[model samples]
Target: MRYIISYVSTVNPDLSNTDIAKLMDHVNVHNNTIGLTGILIYSEGNFFQVLEGEEEIVKRMFERIKKDSRHYNIIKMLDKEMNDHSFSEYHSSFTVISDHYSQTELQEFLNKEKDYNPEHYKSILYLTQKFMKLL
Candidate 1:
């Protein structure tokens, strides 16, 4: 079985682009090394991320995330075990929604995956929408 976790949080406003880039690099390397896959989206001052991998590792990573000083107001949107990882093809993805076009692209990408798992997709889409609304 695979474990998946999705959450939204506010990033530290003081973080510069360079800081965020470095953070993303660390996340990618760490997650890939642990055999995890998922997507992370940031916009305005908010962050939305989904992580899928081994149950223990994902849960451990989430705990570390909760303690990370760079963000706050962590609100978990989803946490459960599933038969497969919906985003196994991607090692780890990070996107910044800077404008309506980027947001639209993200929506389209999620829309295209609607058939993968309706329940999961619905929840993921809803979380993204909710995260976007924070912008």
Candidate 2:
């Protein structure tokens, strides 16, 4: 069964843009290699990401992310089995939302858990879609 794991983390202040680019490249390569898919959302000082794939593979990837030094305060926001992958079209899409939204708005979305209303999930996916197009 496919599973979706959503998480939030705070990027370390010391992290450099080059480090982020290298990390993104590494994630893209690894996700493609393992047939995993997901979307990454970054706004303000937070990192929100949703990874979907086989349970074991997703879990392994999360474990590696937890050990990464570029981010801190890693928190799993959602993890559940899904009938389908919401982001099956992309190995991984990274989005930076800093246009007009406030940091609180971004945090509210990132703090959402699986128990949140279905409409909320749809909204999140919609925003991700919009951001994906921009990227």
> What would the TM-scores of all predictions be?
0.74, 0.68
Question: How far is 89's C-alpha from truth in model 2 (Å)?
Answer: 4.2
lDDT per residue as tens, model 1, 1-135: 988788889998898878887887788787878888776766667778878889999999999999998999998877887666556432333444455554554555476447555766776677777655532
lDDT values, one for every candidate = 0.72, 0.64
Which candidate tops lDDT? 1
User: Per-residue CA lDDT of candidate 2, range 27-130, in tens?
Assistant: 77878678887756655555767788899988988898899888899877567776665554233323464443333333443344334536456655554444
Which predicted model would earn the best TM-score?
1
Clashing pairs in 2: none
> Which segments of candidate 1 are over 4 A away from where they belong?
89-123, 129-135
Scored by lDDT, model 1 comes in at 0.72
Off by over 4 Å in 2: 89-135
The CA-based lDDT of model 2 is what? 0.64
List of clashing residue pairs for candidate 1? none
